[model samples]
Target chain A: MRRARDPFFWGLFSGGGMLTALLLPALFLVTAITAPMGWFGMTGYEEWATLAGHPLTRAGLLLVAFLAFFHAAHRFRYTLYDGLQLYHLDALISIVTYGVAAVLTVLAAALLILVV
Target chain B: MKSQARIPTGRISDPGYPRASNPEYTRHHPRWYRRRMPIFWWLRKLAYTKFILRELTSQPVMYVTLFLLGKMWVLSRGPEAYETFIQWLSHPALLAFHALVLAGLLFHTVTWLNLTPKALVLRVAGRKIPGWAIVGAHYGAWLGLSGAIFWILAGR
Candidate 1:
């Protein structure tokens, strides 16, 4: 059966989430070695800010943020349906979740432009 | 038929509490306290664990709060400011927190990736891609990216 929503969006979002999950930990590790206490603080933050400014990081974070936001929204919709029995209120749940996701996408784009 | 029904009135024995002259009634009733207490207790505990997991995984407000903090920090300082902010993340105490957060993020990624096939509409020659294949591709990419990063960072 055809899905009610765009599946490719989810796939891409999930893929980004997975990629970030893997990359972040290693980045954390390196940050640990070079960093004072294995923590990424203002200096590390600066590096990230640099990444934000960089073309690659900007592109990557934008993709990750857009997809991850929607993926989380969809998961949340299902959670509401199952746990809260919001089946009767499916339309409301979808509207709210997707709406939030849309806002996050815009925010992510803004972050890419201004931060990176 | 009601009037002729046999009523067996036998003293319910409390074998464990033999010392008591008046043992607690063992006869079943609608409320059946003695019979249901154990099962009810087990269910009550089970409900608590489920609640904890739900709270841990989907605490949207908490995640959003942190995410916003990150976003705001980025906006104000740009990369240089963020670098300073990230420097603080390296403290041993913070390392512990990062480890915990990392584990949670990993769980989120795998589960999210697994859902790709279901969430996305992808067809290959009129055939839908299997969910396992979708998940496998994610893992494969993860490994590839990880290896590449390690090679670059390790200066190989």
Candidate 2:
């Protein structure tokens, strides 16, 4: 018998949910909000570039991106299914949402590994 | 005879004909008179509104992750492009949107962490751990993780 995919995706979803909850707020605070506002003397581009390029940081970012994308896809699936009552379009909806998540995860891996 | 009427006789029957033709299947208050839900039905109650909002908060988390990927993509284009990314981030409109996204993400954190006790049950000896301790541990971990990130990003 073929293995079920639900539990695998669910594992990713919950893992991503947990990781995102723990770390994303501070990341946003530093990267988008305070750093953009130039607080804490976070103006230097070279430092960020260097920090991002580190092997460890790139790996961490990739892990976060990979899991977070799946988490989003799973939640978005249920959101549309129940909230908007779009259960009739289950196959189409699942394909679209999870497909987007997969595409975005690949894009993230590319950016983190090849670019940054 | 009534039991004979109730029991199956290995006969095929019209699918909808029986139920539809029943004497009690009145048109005035048909059992099938399900209330058609509007598209925005979740707006009816505060609990539903919050539940949907929590579900939607995942989108912002996804968006922020995408934003991070975009930042890396921008950095690949050289210093000028990176600067442009920062400049775009500094715009009032973009800042406002991010602020809202931030709020959504924070909500997701709080809700998800609080809900963890249900998902992650732990027992010590024969007794289960209390919900508060589990929640507190999550909060504690969140703070520790947040502190490490800030230390790395904001520390000189």
Tens-place lDDT digits, model 1, residues B14-103: 333433433464555456354323322323576644443432343332253235336544546655654555566546787686666656
Q: Where is model 1 more than 4 Å wrong at Cα? A: A1-50, B1-84, B91-94, B111-138, B150-156
Give one digit per residue, the lDDT tens place, for model 2 in A1-116: 11156888788889999999999999988899888888886567888888877889889999999999999998899888888887689789889989999998888787777767
The CA lDDT of each predicted structure is 0.55, 0.85
TM-scores for every candidate against the unseen true structure: 0.55, 0.86
Query: Mind giving the per-residue lDDT tens digits that candidate 1 earns over A1-116?
Result: 11448576556435545555556544444433334343233334444344445577567656656655665666666666655554579889879988887887787677666643
Among all candidates shown, the one with the greatest DockQ: 2
- Docking category for candidate 2? medium
Separately for all candidates shown, the number of backbone clashes (residues 3 or more apart, or on different chains) is: 38, 0
10 residues in a row with least lDDT, candidate 2 chain A = A1-10
RMSD of each: 12.9, 5.4
Interface RMSD of each: 6.2, 1.2
Worst 10 residues of 1 chain A by lDDT: A34-43
